[model samples]
Target: MSTTSTPDNLELATTAREMADQAPAGSLEKAVAGSVAITCATTRTYQEAIDVLGGIQPVEVRRPAIEFLERLAVAAR
Candidate 1:
């Protein structure tokens, strides 16, 4: 976690983990990413990320997607 996260991120991360855990089996990563995105967008319902973002492809893009999810999840609080 970064300086911006602190305790809020912890709580949010836990919630996110629960959300992710409840997601459908094969789409864990997408569900998590969508949860983060929905939280950041302050949407009442969580929607899966439509793009094929969670795939393990090039490193540069993958890392950023993870980072963006974390940042968004924290901001969701």
Candidate 2:
């Protein structure tokens, strides 16, 4: 399979990287953002990536990340 770095995709990738970088060190948000960044770089969906990393638990703790991932997933398409 081949991947082209379209402007939109590149921006998304950069956004994901920034999100991961801005997140607190060793925080769940950081981990999730990092995982999502990897997923965004590939052909996989955010849900698939999140699930594999163990879906955000308690909901409240990861509410922000969840919302962000949802937006990213939509944008990814």
lDDT scores in order: 0.48, 0.58
lDDT of 1 at 41: 42
lDDT of 1 at 44: 28
Instruction: Give TM-scores for every candidate, taking all chains together and pairing residue i with residue i.
Output: 0.35, 0.50
- The reply for model 2, stretches above 4 Å from the true place, is 1-9, 44-67, 73-77
Q: How many backbone clashes does candidate 1 have?
A: 0
Q: How close is candidate 2 to the true structure, as a TM-score?
A: 0.50
Among these predictions, the greatest lDDT belongs to 2
lDDT of 1 by residue, 1-77 (tens): 44343334345445556656776776746555544444434432222221334453554445555565555555664
Which digits, one per residue and each the tens of the lDDT, describe model 2 over residues 1-77?
A: 11232224445556788889998998877876776566556634444444543444546445555556567646555
Candidate 2: residue 24 Cα off by (Å): 1.0
Pairs that clash in candidate 1 = none
